[model samples]
Target chain A: MTQRQALSQSTGGTARGPALALDAGLLCILLVATPMTGSLTLLGETLRSALLFLRELSDWMTKKKLLAGSLAHYEFGVEKLAQAWTLAIALAMIIAGLWIAGLALDLIVTGESQTTSGGLALAAVTLALVTLRSGLQMLPFAQPKPRAFRFASLLVMQSMITLAALADDPSIALLADSFGAAFVALLMTAAGARLFSTAAVDLVDHPLNRKSEAYIAELLLEAGVEEEELLDLRTRRSGRDIFVELTINPSRAGSFEEARQRMGQLRRALAEQRDDLDVAIRLRAPGADSG
Target chain B: MPGPTRDQKSKEAAVLYTSLADLAVVTILFFFAVFTSSLTLLSEAIRVALMLLVEFYGLFVLRALHRDRLRRFRFGIGKVEQMCNLAIGAALLFSGFWVAHSVVAALLSVQAASTPLGLAAAAVISAVNLLINLLGWLAMAAAARDGDSAIYRAQLRARAVKLAASAIVQIAITIAALAKDPVVATLFDGIGAAFVAGVMVTIGFKMVAECLPDLLDHPLPGETKKEIEAALLSAGIAGEELLRLRTRCSGSLPQVELTLAPAGCASVTDYCRRVTAVENHLKDHLGGADVSVVVDARKPAET
Candidate 1:
């Protein structure tokens, strides 16, 4: 990619890299040492076993008059050991969710097949891939940049959530009730695609994108910075900032400050340039560099 | 004359080329290991092949960052390097997973290749790789002599690590090739490759983080503070007050805020001179802390 494209993509969140590395390493260490920590995990498992035993005990107690109390041992066992084992559980949840959802959908939807377990696996993998990369992208923000792609990406994420909720399969009720992986992935993909399309438009230096269009419109209304002759305007985002390098034919001679302040004000309303526009008003003697 | 100047950067680039050569030679050996159908040789060659990217990645990062002052974020493109680093790490990690997959497949399958040719290639490539590593080692040692060169020094250290790892891989490949089993060779090579990639991803991740912290507006070095603090203290003020300080990496110098000890406290000219002096001190210490003095009475302690 060109440098501009790369810089445009380098949002502040990329700083997450160090934290991710640190977190992953910590997770691995915890996974390796879990056997020694037979404290919480073992306790939970023991409680689960006790609960199972009590189920039998309670039935017998009900029949006899002596010890008639039901010993209800709550067993939410093995849930606390969210180490590498968490990954296994996540995989399982993904699998079970897919299997149930697919079966239900297949029952209702004529053309759909319940045996697309592999596709469900692929969906889980895809989500994992996106999440993993998104985490890395967040790493840049640690250092702080003047601009970032927060607005665009966040819009995309939100859309995914909305689309997923509204998405309908042929067996819509079954898919929704069963909470299938296929259903989740499908909605997510549709939402993401919508958001990405907008982002893509923004990336291509679309002047009509909300920010620039507002900026140019604002500029036209300004009496101070407006010149009768300004043309071939182009603009693009750099992180949170918007840079515009265009030629203007001023209405007669004017103070440079007057022109600068106007353009500066316009910049502020658009991106980081709005309140933090760093303006470099270079004077052009009509025929400066080219002519 | 203080140091080798920009030439040091060129030398680092040269070091990268040398190490990549070592990898290329090892890859040649790798092909033979597969051909000879020696489990050990194939595995060893695969191991070496796996690590090739790690060496290349170090080169890429070191070479990219080895120049110029920190550019102002106003241009917004400086962070492009970080993006490139992140992209590269993701690619390497994905490739590592692929390498692991292949290893598992080979472990289960009856895959084999021709052997005698692989052994001869391994021998030849090992000698060539050793030579390349030596060149890289010399370049690294030369670069490190300039202790003041933080960026170049980092490059040197990264290259040295690659050189050491490549040498280790070469030894393993030779041993595996002698064992005469292709499966063993594939296993050794595949595992080794994945491990090397893991290391690269981790390293790349870290180096990028260092730069990212600055992007996040994390506090920079205190040289600017020292100047501001010295300026306030120069006014003969009593007690240690921080005076408000805000800093951002703008253009040429980082804009630093140094709050004064309030109105009734000290000589403005002397305070101003001291502030100016501090600004100069900051500019010297912090390649370019803009040294802008903001006299804040409310946040006096931060000065």
Candidate 2:
């Protein structure tokens, strides 16, 4: 198979990581920032609560079945409803996260506590929960399932990096502003790279699209337009639209009305086969410079 | 039929609201930047201000699109959105490159200052921006649920990106606030600014690439072309030899043109009937397509 075909086949798998990675990258910045400014008093519990909240959120989402399992099986207008539901779910997660954070903040500001070794376990759980939450959050935003998977993978990467950073020193603030910036920069670069690659594919004609031109040629030939009568035919596909051009010589001469009648027959014949054909037909004599 | 569909009108209103909201936010940000001495704040404010202006112009384009759709213009100005993509893409790219440069310079030589108030202000603005964008996204998403319009999809993406960007800014600013050292805070601020820019540029670049084909009037996809060709070919009449065929698409509508030479001598009636039949056939298949069939007496010279 050609490279394009190969890419097309594996698009499902390839699409799974980037979006997740990008989301993760964003979360990484957030996770890194959390402990930087806040009081360390409730750090473990707050993070642990955050993890618990994510688990509950995930379970709630699973129970509700908010996201469509397969977008294709659904009818056209229905997809949007699913999309809206997903958006609502994402919004709800954000609101919930904020609420939990507020409660955590209240606890931290009101009371004082010492840092404990449990901080490590809480941090790990938080990382896992955040990764799961990020994936769910991105689910509605991504169109195809594979793209969602890709996004989840990216989120995982981001979560891992942030977890590593947090693991280094939970008490003291790390002057790692560059790290956040670098994480974002790296994600952008990766996004840019993907864009360029996708652009390359889009710029060229897909094999299926190319086949359409030939298909048109075959259809005309099958319609009994002799090879000699057919002057020129051109076909091109633009996104979801199609363009076709055909030229042929007539076998008989008659008045304009008679000619139009004959053209009518041809059009009806073509229409019977396909209803959504945008066709323009031109008639010319055998030796004319122009029509 | 008499006026815009409920969905269309709602979408238009949503776009208008977002554009105005963006303008307001950026204006507030600009004033905040003016009062603060942070280079990062000033730069981002300028960047966002440019974005709002571009979005304002985009609102005009959306208006044009609505008017065209209402009038049922033969060639809709749908591709005009491509221009928005181009403009926004430029802004994002410029911001990214500029911010990258700023971050590099900061890394090489740091200018240390304490601006807790500025950081606090940015954090608040980021929160407000986030709220605005989230609501906008919800509105647009709901609007999009009825039918998938390219404009709606674009708006959705834009709102989501804005939300993400705002959240990132808020986090970065808060981190900077927590840092003990002034240089460390500056570094964090620079990083956040750069990250936002990077995401913008990446997305903007993709937008430009996606719109280029539409702006350039690229050919329709293969399946659509095949459908059109099949309809025209099957519509052919006896004694009529197909000569030349050409097809193109404008927005969602397809257009096909073909040359045919009728067999023997044909009268005006015959020509009319033939052309009418073909036109009708095409109309039936490609409902919204602009189809035309021409009969030519003149033929190519024999070699």
Native interface contacts kept by each candidate, as a fraction: 0.00, 0.22
Full-model lDDT for every candidate = 0.42, 0.54
Stretches > 4 Å off in candidate 1? A1-238, A241-291, B1-130, B143-151, B180-191, B194-198, B220-244, B248-275, B284-290, B294-303
Candidate 2 residue-wise lDDT, A26-118, digit = tens: 455446644653423223223333333443344333323323233222211121222223322333333333333433343434443232335
The CA-based lDDT of model 2 is what? 0.54
Could you give me the TM-score of model 2 versus the true structure?
0.47
Would you give me the overall lDDT of model 1? 0.42
DockQ of 1: 0.03
Interface RMSD of 2: 12.1
Please tell me which predicted candidate would have the highest lDDT against the true structure: 2
Report the number of the highest-TM-score candidate. Answer: 2
